[model samples]
Target: MDVRTLEYFVAAVECGGFTKAAARLHVTQPTLSEAIRRLERECDAPLFHRVGRGVVLSEAGAVLLTYARRVLKDMEDARQSMIALRGFQGGRVTVSAPPALSIEPLARIVGNFRRAYPDVTVVMLPTEDGALAAAAVANAASEVGLTDRPVSADLRAHPIGSNEIVVVLPPGNALSGKGPVSLEQLAGVPFISSAVGTRARNLLDESKERGIALQTAVETPHREAVIPLILEGVGAAFLPWTVSREAESRGAVVLPLLPRVAYDLLIVHRDQPLTAAAEAFVATALGSSPVGGD
Candidate 1:
């Protein structure tokens, strides 16, 4: 199969549609469609299933996607290797991280990395799911990932730091005066929670698993809205201690959970070899100094 065809196929999966992929590749829709068709013919199987106005990957397509990404990544790595032999002048490193958990430190790290290596371009992939952080690295879509969740055994992860998860309450709420509130105490109160699949949502699920039937007052995807909603007396919610500290100054009462919970931030990458720029990033993040420091 032609590498170009595989490139088009992967682009379709990432962009979510042929038209979008075509626009992304700066190619005509017909050209993109023809390339995908050729790929399907070579594989002798339909890779995508037409659903509504868009297409979803078929079982065959999903299988092909995994190998396609590896092949593309290998090709890129080979090219970057040659570029590095001459001089490490210009190279790109893509990094992914869970959105809510990594806002502060990752931003600092990226800012520092750019200032230190001005010629090295850093691409930050936007992702909300914490799991995607590690998956991005495994799939070769990104060179490295910053995640708060555990990575699979096939991947290598480095401990960066940890963040405390705390409960936030409104000023007039009964729990406001409490020092450390147990999940049991908040069981009767309506709970504002992060949306499904997010780390905060996982904590809420953990509470339920522990036998606390916390009523869902509101479920939102907006991490920024969590404190504001609590301040408005919408309901209590759990947030990172650093974030909760900011809310505490703004009239929201921050209290530690009965059983303290903290998630470790890890720098994750595939077990396989990484490009030079990726290794540099890993070293910088793992170093004792602040992200981007000498």
Candidate 2:
């Protein structure tokens, strides 16, 4: 009948029954039961039937469930939108980034964002999946995300930066001294790879596109873990230029990819209108000169 009734009903459905839903919702079973009863009466249809051990959705219930979830989600988003506009100094921001950027570039962005928005809490997550897109689609995270790509059409994606993909070689390897690394150059050498959400995956796909045979000696989700294998000469890898640059400063020679492969960094958000805090966060990421373009 309303947001509360829909929520109570959905929770009851997901938790399998009124008793379980009441426990989860921290409410009395009869209270939740009454709400579902009201919902069914409002629709003038029996939504669920007691089927031995638990409740099963009736045909009408099946249809109502779909609309109920949407209404609940919209209600939640409405509250979130108002919270954003409240302009509270203390708030939360969840960010998802690729592994390498999560360590360096994303860290820097959060650092600066913290100083500017000191009371805001920043949550940074690194993943091999399209976490940014997935989060936005599910409404499970902050509206702003930094990622290599926004693969979901339900989100708006803006290419914000580019990260270098450098060839990492082990010490004493024959090609170590080469100023630049190329796919052809690493042809026979075994490769170390990033597990997912990485330009490495894209690189692997490119190899497939070109019909280039490849071998991966090691694979890791974290670039920090990937680098040590290169140090051990396990095989070479392609990682963010930031990692390569750090290596270069530490006496590890990093060379550009000969054919010029680059990781395009994109900022993504839900396709719908954004919250005020989210808008501010977007403005900050877009306008902040953390990469020293200034």
Candidate 3:
């Protein structure tokens, strides 16, 4: 049906009934109900069924709602496309990456992009699950994702670089002068591990699966915070070598994990050739700015 009907239908689902939706839409209850009824008639299925005191989506309604969201989004995309063609002052691009990586590089990259384009907008997102690939594939985000893994087989891959996991030792630990500690070496020590749900913990688990037993004494969401405790010699923590590099440069001795565990930082795009903007970003990240000499 019309966009108005879809909008009303979506509102009904959100507001739980025609009356509430009518109030929210600043329309009469009868008008909202008629619109939804028209929509249901056109689709040949009831979109909602009445419960005791509330309304809920029927089986058919539930299925349509999912598609309704996608349709509305595509409408938005169409609008944005038209705006871009008119030489709009700005366009938004969604980018996702882990918190640790975004904190440092995003600012510089965004600044550079703005300086060059002056009109493009960036929506920066920090992902938690460590699966940037899935987010990109779903198109909830842009084709480009910064993560340890490729977004999907259907997407392309480019390495931004790699980071090593280092052991953060507690202050004044007797383990000084010990070169290259293995996961096996720290088997008995009380260690803080990355929290269970994050990508870091998954990496640790996979490492464990590969015969490396991690002795985690604490589990934290921000593993970077574990650095200070290590300097105090409280316990050992593992973090990206880039993280450890900053520490080492500042007098923290970041020993390499034995067997040399390294995580690659990747710039992944949809398996298809990237969009012009997404391609530009990948180039900028790879230190190849458009104007020559990044």
Best by TM-score: 1
How much lDDT does each candidate structure score? 0.81, 0.69, 0.66
Off by over 4 Å in 3: 1-88, 104-107, 172-179, 197-199, 203-214, 222-224, 246-251, 271-276, 288-294
TM-score of each model, in listed order: 0.87, 0.69, 0.68
Candidate 3 colliding pairs: 133-151, 154-271, 155-271, 164-241, 169-230, 170-233, 170-234, 171-232, 171-233, 191-217
Indicate the worst ten consecutive residues by lDDT in candidate 1.
285-294
**Model 1 lDDT tens row, 97-160:** 8765456568777777777778888888877766888898888888789887888998999987
lDDT of 2: 0.69
Give lDDT tens digits, candidate 2, residues 1-294: 677788888887787788898999899988988888888888999989997767988999888876776666556557657776676555566677655666556777777777787877776655554454345434543456777654677677776667667776676667666777667766767888786655676786587578666677777766567777777667777766766766555545466778776656667776777655556667667765544111
Output the lDDT of residue 25, model 3.
88
Off by over 4 Å in 1: 51-53, 172-178, 208-215, 288-294
- TM-score: which is higher, 2 or 3? 2
Evaluate model 3: give its lDDT.
0.66
